[model samples]
Target chain A: MERKRASLKFLVTVMSNQAASTPAALKHTPLNATHRELSAKMVDFGGWDMPVNYGSQIEEHHVVRTGCGLFDVSHMLPLDIKGANVRAFLKRLVANNVDKLQVSGKALYSCMLNEAGGVIDDLIIYFMDESWFRLVVNAGTAEKDLAWMEKMNADWDMGLTLTPRRDLAMIAIQGPNATQALNHALPGVDSITAHLKPFNAAAMGEMFIARTGYTGEDGYEVMVLAKSAPFFWKALMEAGGKPIGLGARDTLRLEAGMNLYGQDMDETTSPLESGLAWTVDMKTERDFVGRAALEKSEITQQLVGLLLLDKGVLRGHQKVLTKHGEGEITSGTFSPTMQQSIALARIPLGIAPGEEVEVEIRDKKLKAKVVKYPFVRNGKVLI
Target chain B: MSIPADLKYTPSHEWVRVEADGTLTVGITHHAQDLLGDMVFIENPATGRSLAKGEECAVVESVKAASDVYAPVAGEVISANADVESSPEAINKDAYSAWMFKLKPANAADVAGLMDAAAYQKLVESEAH
Candidate 1:
């Protein structure tokens, strides 16, 4: 607990500090004006002027888990890969097997790795055809991912054209009633999306709707023309979709046990230690970019979920003391659904689930328990 | 924006209400809670703890982050408001009314040394820009 006695002063100081920094222009999503109209508190997130919340983040979080909530996820880049050898290029480029995606509109979650087995970015690859695939990657890492892909294309001599669709806007509507809300908003959408399974997608006119989301709930990530985003958002709101923001987005994802690219894993962290071993296809003899490095490296740390047994909210960067060794929290928050504090920590491998550990909060060490993740899914607490 | 004219204030945004019994009541201002947003946890100074002026004595955590509550004027912490500790949201709902601790001032004149409501309001206005 580093006492931020001057924290109120610090907030003012930070705002003043921003003046001294090079005032690089922040990018805006297509729904920027709508967010302002809704009285959203906007913040600079990875150079994008995105909404952190409408008013109350916790209330917005409940709206998503219980009813329906919409998020403007346009900052996430969508790249369309088209060529005869697109499948071949992806199989070599990503850690997961692109060969798994045999049917059209099927999605695969994979970590695009560096040669050193570090995660460059985690992405969702949607196979449209043998010659075409679409990848949705983290906003902050989009440039680096594209550069890496271009490098790989040149090196492999694969004539795939990677087209970044910046002309599009994406909105994710999520919750238990998401599908119904979406159907109500866009009549006849139920018929098209009804048969779609998890991790599947379909095209409806100019829109590409994926039955996928960051929040652990039934939803669609719909990509539409940028100009039509405002109208689409309004329609969804009218159909009972509450406008959620990034603050709630974070709490929702953390409760779902999903990994955030920057916090849960980064360039220096291996997927093996980052709770992403499943995404790394070790069974296949097919060599990928980081195959040799992953095979050669030994995993020392493992990511696990934690539930605080005592008072106090858990937060990122808190130190953990276990019998085996010390660890650190990757991401932590008070789960609005659980009414308790939960965290994902990277600790020594020997620490198994159900074992008790101590987490340092402020100066006091409080007791906590190691548990499996996905703490809450489908409005139910799992652990 | 709602600074009680009767209370004294600190540059750190804490409010001090001088009680008739020579004990002083303390809490964060409404402006402080508004800036912090959505209080989740609060740790008040333990009862009977002696403190110097401006000491980092208590802690208030919002969903966004944690912040320390400094002692406005040096005193002995006579009692802590357990209600604020358990239901931190009370502070966010009404920061001025949700007092954190009762302090027995070491020097009663020290309360006068702190800023009046008008001066504190001016400071807040300056900070906003």
Candidate 2:
């Protein structure tokens, strides 16, 4: 398997000399100082100085799954689109049908694709009105997504105003007790958020709280003004909400069967082969950017889940030895919830669940089992 | 940061306990576990395996990544700690007490070449800056 050179791989390497020489070159989130005060281990995550963990990543993962944990996800950008032709523009821009989001606070997950049926970025769109839609995009791909959208807007003459909300800071409070913790942290929020369902959001004062999270847990992704973030983070911590970092976030998302954009699927791979075919709307005849290419191409590989039966931790770039052919692990981690190593591998078709495969870890070939994932959900092990 | 004064140390962060039998019990220091985070898996060298000084013999994996645990000095592996391999979190809980492997040193004088607590502490402080 070919290992892609990304920040995730270098998380373990200590670059003390480089950090000393150019400390100011890295970008900081609003809670950077607070993270340092909390003694978080900060790392360079896609040029952003983000916390990998405050203490134990496994503890943070358990806290998010069992109790309450807060994550400073401000690195993710929220873009606001406003125009009379917004809905029409979205239909052509995204691979999923935006019309499905009828309720004002409802959200839809979609992949923004390139012309050759490859994924550009996977984002969440919140429908606020006929003319305005809010999009939350990944941190590393925010600028690239904006550039592509701008080029498309110019070509289509949509007259839409794309406003990137860099002035906001996002905090994800997740767990089974997340709602109660949020109530403890920011009293009287339940009045506005009590009835909120999955994929729904509400505006309370200046904060936009969404009942959504990357971790497979009940939580809210609250976006507040950048200046108010530190105070919000402090309040949450005071309410017994542990501060979780990106290390736990990666493991949580991987166990939840969610794809990491750069690791799982990128500009070179389409959603069909990336275990995201359900999100790609093909039932109705709507021509999106990559629709024609997807129709013309043949999908040969499939993304599936793996459970290591042996005693080693599964990791990205490991080669998979399947009966049909060779495959590569896209995202892998030791699942704190499952107490075992789990991963998502792109393998050939016809590989069914319950089948055994071998993953080459270092010099040893470890036994593993193919399984359907979301290996964990809502603090419970599924497969 | 708790480097027991009596125990010897290696620059790579392994701590050694000189048993009554002159055999050495070795484990990664507390600082090593702090940097590596919670231990999820550990692969120790076989009991009979012989090792050279500074040879990478065992593997220790945390949730974030894996690391190599090297042999502190030239020695034959006297015994491996089975407790650590099955329950790796013991190392995170008490790094000093949860030993990884015991080694029978080729020469007792080789342990003298390793760092003392005071010298290892100085090396750690320098790395911090």
Candidate 3:
């Protein structure tokens, strides 16, 4: 038993180091050469050598807010689960209710939780049919999430066939003109995607197009063959979709009040406290993993949006002092649209919107106001 | 990318230009701004504040991350650039022209101890590898 435990500890260390590997050992997406050709500034993001920006990250962000921007999101894993029991399996696998997904191609955003009520990863589940489902998970947590799903599959005796779609590459075309650029790029995609609403997907040939995005904008997350990524990227560019990088992606998401996996929450953070309580579907009688723990857990903290009133920029891990208690900023960035700094903080409960809070930046405490998030959506500033 | 031969540099990437009046104008290097991506905010040390050599006296925050600007030599800050603080993107436009602060060095000769253009260029190259 001691030897087994020692080997388990070693395995955990090795797995965690996958994203901390040296630059030489970093992984590359299918569009690595394309990014290099575009003169993109590359950085080690979750062990993947990915582009941070082509030029000004703020400009790229504004482009996404106003016009069309293309992003190579191939690093995120596309997992397909197929079986007669696929729906049954997912009913207990994730926190959200799968029953809401009666219509085919409908997508549901959910948080997969551990037995301890901690979030494993937030993912988008697309119901293709009663027998098949597709899930898009975060890049950094792909391996561990897959392992967890595989373990649960066996433990529950659910004989579903899980396939990691590494052969596919995803591109997110976002902004107000996203659909126009997408239709221009693919020519006939408009006919298929024109009627599709948000949180819906459609498959044309081998490509999967979902009308969903991380940035709170009108966009589609299109998946194509990995070998065809560069061609698709070039086509999108020719169709007036400017290539955007991860740096802009981050700022855009923060302004949109989205949670990043590692930054906002992790294996130790519960979905209740991570501003994902709405996605947790506790009203359903269907039993899911972590439901018991979530039922018994006392909610002490709640995630809220903060608008920095001071001149400085708010950053992650900064202390947030509220009248109720102290909290920490999970994700923070300068919202180019608002021309102000915004952040998401997990503070003690009872700090209502419109209340003032102090965010400690270095030695000084800057004033910030608690506000309802989604700071910018579809080029409009809400707060 | 542009390391002016007349200017001096610190290992931390701050570039110092000695003015005709024996004062020094300081800003981040072009390479530093390139690495930090788009500029968002800047905080310069208060004017007349005494600083030690290599003391972190200013801050330059880009969209990607926040970095410190150290005092190249023991000095008193004479002026802070309000223009750059208001429009921090000026640094990305031209790092040398968007000086963050001015300092009256305790010893003007201390500028000679900092890295020259060629030495700083070499240091930046070495760091990239």
TM-score of the A-chain for all models = 0.96, 0.96, 0.94
User: For model 1, how does the per-residue alpha-carbon lDDT over A277-346 read when each residue is reduced to its tens digit?
Assistant: 9999989788899999999999899999999999888888899999988999999988889988999999
- How high is the CA lDDT of each candidate model? 0.89, 0.90, 0.88
Model 2: colliding residue pairs? none
Reference contact recovery of candidate 1: 0.29
Question: True interface contacts reproduced by each model, as a fraction?
Answer: 0.29, 0.29, 0.27
Q: Write model 1 residue lDDT over B33-110, tens digit each, in one string.
A: 766667888889989999999888998877777777789988999999998888888987888889999999999988
State residue A366's C-alpha deviation in candidate 3, in Å: 0.8
Q: What is the per-residue lDDT of model 3 for residues A42-115, given as tens digits with 9 covering 90 to 100?
A: 77787788888899898999999999999999999999999999999999999999889999999999999999
lDDT of 3 by residue, B1-129 (tens): 568999999877788999999999999888777767678999999999999998878888877666677899999999999999999999999999999999999997888899999998887665654
Docking class of 1: acceptable
Model 2, A1-383: lDDT tens per residue?
Answer: 44332221132235332233254788888998999899888877898988889888988999999999999999999999999999999999999999899999999999999999999999999999999999999999999999999899989999999999999999999999889889988988979667999999999889999999999999999999999999999999888899999999999999899999999999999899999999999999888999999999999899999999999999888999998999999999899988999999999999999999999987789999999988999999999
TM-score of each: 0.96, 0.94, 0.95
Q: Compare the candidates by TM-score and give the number of the best one.
A: 1
Q: Candidate 1, which segments miss by more than 4 Å at Cα?
A: A1-6, A12-24
Which scores higher on lDDT, 1 or 2?
2
- lDDT of candidate 3 at residue A203, scale 0 to 100: 95
What is the Cα-based lDDT of residue B102 in candidate 1?
96
Best by DockQ: 1
